[model samples]
Target: MRTDDVLEVMNELVAFVRVAEAGSFSAAARQHGQTPSAVSRQVARLEKVMGVALLQRSTRQLRLTEAGLDVLERGREMVAAAQATVRVAEGHVGVPRGRVRISAPKAFARQVLQQPLLSFLQRCPEVDLHLMVVDRPVDALREGVDLVIRLTDDPPPGMVARALMPVRQLLLASPAYLSGRPPVRTPEDLMAHSCLSLGEQERDNRWRWVRGGDVVEVAVSGRYTVNHSEMRLAAVEAGLGVGCVPDFVARDALAAGRVVQLLPDWVFDNHYQGTAYLLFAASRHTAPKVRALIDHLVAALGPCAQPV
Candidate 1:
């Protein structure tokens, strides 16, 4: 085949892959600035050239055939390799200029990401930063986000991830609440106090504490319970009860003497406190825009540094 023929075939494969990824021919058309019929024709031509049916089409949905599934997996790799090649060639010659979209939780976005991102924006004038702050799970790749910063013990599977920081959970109570209340010198003493419950409706009111090879589990009850970190912090600050909170969330209050740590030596064993990971698609690690932001975040936020 001629060079032009090879390029045409590659374009067709890309069109097919985009349609599959977008989940609709119309969506791919909108992305590529082409009509749906044109994109469909491109896929049809590729099917004819390869002598196999790729997609089973209906009015409501499009499903990939077995051949389409195999083609898509390989085609994405080829497209990524091509993109990486372009990025490498351009990086040596041009400045980093592109939009980098990031998905993060609402609370983390407001509290943690805002300052670092502001610094990153100042440093990279050519780059446009897009933040998608949601309280629920996000489909990073499908939604076209370039990176994600999430608090989890385990990062999402099949992605390149770096542990940026370890989140620490500690029990806390406002100084006002602690005053005239039973002294919480030990984990066992928590039973006599008003404990803030997380997921009070779903689980038993049991709190776990660990300190230097010693583990203790105590069953405690509370008047107020909430699922959100900020809410728990608010209730604790209002002198409602003793609540468990991430160190980052309670840092300002602790320092301001608004809330006091209950057990300084003990750590909460709940899954809420773990590590914050910087995650991105494995293929786009070398891209200039993505690489610059990842490097900046790791540097400013102190990668793998646990909160004191």
Candidate 2:
């Protein structure tokens, strides 16, 4: 096929895959921002090009033929490869004038990263930042996000991750809550108190503390459960319970004595211990905007902190 013919065929195949996945031409049309007839025509064009019927369609239901299933499996890989190729080409130019989409946790995006990013943007006027604040991991390529900031002990597979910093996890409790309670000098003392929970993971309800060479895991329970780390920190400030949170998030509160460190000698280590990584496709290294943002983040977060 000619180059343009190949491109048209790939586009049609992709449209067919979308229709099959969505289970309706109309749904795929909405997804692709094209008319239903246009979507149907594209699928038909794909079937004609491939010399196979791709879909079994009816007023009641849409079903994929065996050829459609084969195309779906192969088409996804083709699309991904094509995208990676484009990204690689974009990276090499280093023009740095396009929008850079980033995904990060809401609290970190708002509290920790936003100010620094804003400052970076002020200095680099050519780049536009699109920040998607969420509490869950996003598929960087599929979501069309240029980069992602994740707090993880181990970086996710198949991406170039640049760690920003080592977040110090600390155990904190409000002075009001500790007024009558004895000082907690060890992990064992936490057994007598309530611990706030963050994230839905069962592991979040457990506390891990390290002292000298020993590491301890204590199962903790609380009256409040929150998905956002900021909310958990606020609950700790309100004297509701002892909460373990990142030092950066609670730094001001700790300084103001709103929340005092509990078990000062026993540190929470290797649990909730992770560096914030600026994850992106390795191909994006050449893109000017992506490279600029990565450089800014490394400078802001520090170079020695995150491995390249």
Candidate 3:
């Protein structure tokens, strides 16, 4: 085949795969800067070339046939390979440009990462960022994200995880709450106090404390149990109860003397204790935009981590 012929075929395959992944030609068209009719024609041309029906279309929805499913499964890899090839070539010849999509939990992104991301964009003039704040771990490939910032001890399989920082949660109480109460000297001391905690996990009600290689779980009850870390912090600030909260969330309050760290020698562990990592496809490591963002994250946030 001629060079143009190969390029044409690849383009058609890219279009078809995008439509399959998006579940609608219109969505694919919007993503790729094409009209739905044009995208539909590309898929039609690809089907003709392959001599098979690739999709079953109706007014309300689009479904893939067996042949279409086969094409989609294989074609996605080809599209990725092609994108990687382009990124590699761009890495060699040009400054990092184009949009970099990132997926992260909303509260964390807003509370901690927002300012840093803005600082990064200010420094890197050629780079554009698309931030998606999601509560759950998103499929990077399916979501078309360049990176995912996740708080996890074990990252998902088949991705490169660079630990940006170790997350530390500490037991804390407002100075007001601690003023008249008996001093907490040990794990057992917490038994007499109301402990605000996360309600989502069984482990939340059963608080874990670590001190000098000794770990203990205490079954504690609370007047308030919340799913959000900030809420727990709020309850603690209001002198409701002692709560487990990350250092980042409590740092400002601690500095301001609004809240004091309880059991200073003991470390509190929660569901996301291990680390915050920047995850990406291994193939995209050489992409300059990915490298730039990772560098910024490491430089800005890594040093702030409290020692584990």
Identify the leading candidate in terms of lDDT.
1
Go through the candidates in order and give each one's C-alpha lDDT: 0.85, 0.82, 0.83
What lDDT score is found at residue 221 in candidate 1?
89
> Per-residue lDDT for 1-308 in model 1, tens only?
35575467998999999999999999999998999999999999989878889999999999999999999999999999999998767863457677889988777777788999999998989889999998666777889888887788877888788777778887889888888878998889999999888773454478888989999999998899787788999999998999987778888988998888878888888766688777887773366877888888888776564322
> Which is the winner by lDDT between candidate 1 and candidate 2?
1
lDDT of 3 by residue, 32-98 (tens): 8999999999999988778889999999999999999998998988888888998768754457766
Per-candidate count of clashing residue pairs (backbone under 3 Å) = 1, 4, 0
Clashing pairs in 3: none
**Model 2 alpha-carbon miss at residue 63, Å:** 57
User: Candidate 2 lDDT, tens digit per residue, 245-273?
Assistant: 88788889988889888776777865455
**Residue 203 error for model 2, in Å?**
3.7
TM-score of model number 1: 0.67
In candidate 1, how many Å is residue 55 off? 43
TM-scores of the candidates in the order shown: 0.67, 0.66, 0.67
The better-scoring model by TM-score among 2 and 3 is 3
Clashing pairs in 1: 164-304
